[model samples]
Target: MSAFAERKEMIMTKKTAYEFAYITFAMFIISCSIYFFLIPSGIVVGSISGLSMVLNQVINLPISLITFILNIGLLVIGFIFIGKEFGAKTVYTSILLPVFLAIFEKICPLSESLTHNSVYDLVSYTLIIAFGQAMLFNVNASSGGLDIVGKIISKYTHLEIGKALTVCGMITAATSIFVYDISTMIVSLIGTYANGQAVDYFVGGFNKRKRICILSEHYEEIMKYIMEDMNRGVTIYSAVGGFDKTPRIEVVTIMTTSEYKKLLNYLHQSDYKAFVTVSTVNEVIGTWNINKNSRKSKQKEVSVQ
Candidate 1:
């Protein structure tokens, strides 16, 4: 192989290793929340784990075993319908979660609730599971089961993952009514909502970008710094100040949070009086760093690799 190819392969290998390590730790956190808090308290917060909890009550089977079986079935459906990428991304966490749960169960079995307070326990586990799932989702990985179904919903229906997961959770939470009392079902619904909120809260910051508009007397210097030093694109617009009605140049650019911080620091040092307006950008299209054709060709090359 060429030197470039070898280097690229090494980078990809390192990335994959890091991803698995992170996913493993996230799954372990989820498993601990399940075995320690949720299981003992009978709080079903909607997921394969929640469904397994309900089923285990009726069939008297191990929750870990039930989760394993359900995840396997979901994996098959995901592979056939959702495409190879989704299946491949989910395979590790889907399989590992049940293994972790089983190991935790064997090593440190829970006979009763840890705190003996159902409300606090449910909230604690909700936060823990939500954070773990957020970590997985941030990395474009999932804990599998209904998450695969959520992805299917998002892909075909164009629903957001959080909304799709909420829909799935509602269905699973409804089933909890049969296994537990109405009060338990209410708690499950609240926990489900909290879970979605926590995931959104944590995952939102990771992909969020800033859209910055700078009206500066030294627009040229700012633009030069952005284009040459920061290596980011900028769009200049001719504008008139509403108050003074004077024609001025408005520099606009979109950048990640880190880049925004750097640009803000530069503005403070160089042009402290620059009129800046920053807003959140949910998404960006096209290439930020390279030409369109080059980006398309690079994508194709990466796919081939």
Candidate 2:
């Protein structure tokens, strides 16, 4: 096997390990939200666990058992609608959530509400669940339950994933009325809205990059640094200044936070009078070419400039 191929395999193995760690931690957080906050408060937000809670009231089954059964059913639906890749990742999370819930139930049961206030419990659940959901989404996985529903909604209707989650959650939240008072039901609805917004915020912020456009006489030097040192691609365009009517070369590139900082420092130290505009990009589509290209050479001489 070529050295490059071996390195690629090693990178893929490392990435898979990282993703497993992330999935586990994300499920643990969601479990904490359900067991520590939602269970005692009886707040039904838009989630599989919420649905399980509602069903448990009627069927007299354990909440964890109800959740596991519902997730099993949802997983099949997910496989049919959301694609096999999603179904595979979700299978892990769906099972882990129920298992984690059972573990917490046995080890340290929350016999009573932690905050004793519905609003506090709702907020806690929203914050923790939102963060966990964002992490899963970043890895192209989900926490199962309403996430599968949200994925279906977004895929068919072209609605944003976060909004889809809110829509599905509101429906689940409405079910709270069957089990709780009007006031508690209202709290659930509010919690559902807040949860969607938090998820949107975190999801959008997860892979954010800076889109930078630079107009400078030293465009060649800047572009070279960006390409060679930063391992980033750049696009150059010819432009005429609207006000000054001066011909200028515009260099544009998308950079991660650290790369942007390094470029900023390079410009400052070089004392270049560059006109730079930066915009926060939430996501990048297509090939971004962020990684260094592997060479076929097994061994190469090292040189320090």
Candidate 3:
């Protein structure tokens, strides 16, 4: 291959490796939550695993085996109906989760609750599983099972995936009433709601950005810090003060939360009188590129100059 082609191949290989690593870690977290807390307590938090839990009571099969079979069936459905991309993204996670659970069971089998309090177990497992699933979603993947159903519903109805998943989860949680007591069923409903909330929280946080507007006598300093130190782009717009009728330069920039915090601290120390307004930005689409390695080299060049 040519040099450019070889480099592109290398980049693609690295990206695929990174994606698999992330998915593996996320699935492991889900498995740990299920094996340690959810399974033993019978919380039934509403998914394929929850359904497997309910089925295990009657079928006398291993939860891992049940999850594996269900996920395999879902994979076939996803491939046929949803699309190839969804199926490819979900296949590894769907299979790995059950394998991880099986390994966990072999290493440390649990006949009783890890904690004496069922509420604590439910809360802990709910949060862990939700966060892991959120991570998977952020990477454009899923844990298979009912998520495949959610995807199918979303495709035909044009519904949001979150709403679709919630509906599916509620239905799965409702089935818990038949297998467990009323109290368990109630916890399952609450866990389902909490799981959705947790996913929203994590996903929102992952994508959150800050839009900052600054009207300052020290616009040059602020702009320099942002452009040079932070390696972020800024737009300078001319503005006329409404009260004073004075011409001014307004500096606007978008940055991640950590970068915003650092900029805030720098502004406080450098220009205490600088007027600043900040807002949470849900989405940003632009051609501006912020490459960390390139930024670091540029910073070093600036410092040397």
Candidate 1: global Cα-lDDT? 0.83
lDDT preference between candidates 1 and 2, better one: 2
Worst lDDT run of 10 residues, candidate 1, spans: 289-298
Candidate 1 per-residue C-alpha lDDT over 162-252 given as tens digits, one digit per residue, 9 for 90 to 100: 7778889988988898888998888888888787777667667665799999999999999999976777889999999789899999999
lDDT of 3 at 94: 69
Lowest lDDT 10-mer window, candidate 3? 287-296
TM-score top scorer = 2
Relative to the true structure, candidate 1 reaches a TM of 0.82
Which residue pairs in candidate 2 have backbone atoms (N, alpha carbon, C) closer than 3 angstroms, thus clashing? none
- Residue lDDT tens for model 3, 1-305: 75445655665677779888998999999889988988777667789878998899989999879988988898999899967867898988867977998899899988898887889898989889878887887677888888788778867897655677778888999988888888878888888878777776776777779999999999998999998788788999999999999999999999999999999999999989988999998656564434454456555656766
Candidate 2: where are CA atoms >4 Å away? Answer: 53-66, 289-305
Poorly placed runs, candidate 3 (over 4 Å): 1-12, 52-70, 76-86, 150-163, 178-181, 218-221, 224-229, 268-272, 285-305
lDDT of 1 at 282: 67
lDDT of each: 0.83, 0.84, 0.83
Q: What C-alpha lDDT, on a 0 to 100 scale, does residue 287 get in candidate 1?
A: 70
Q: At residue 246, give the lDDT of candidate 3.
A: 99
**Which parts of model 1 have CA positions greater than 4 angstroms off?**
1-7, 52-66, 106-111, 243-245, 285-305
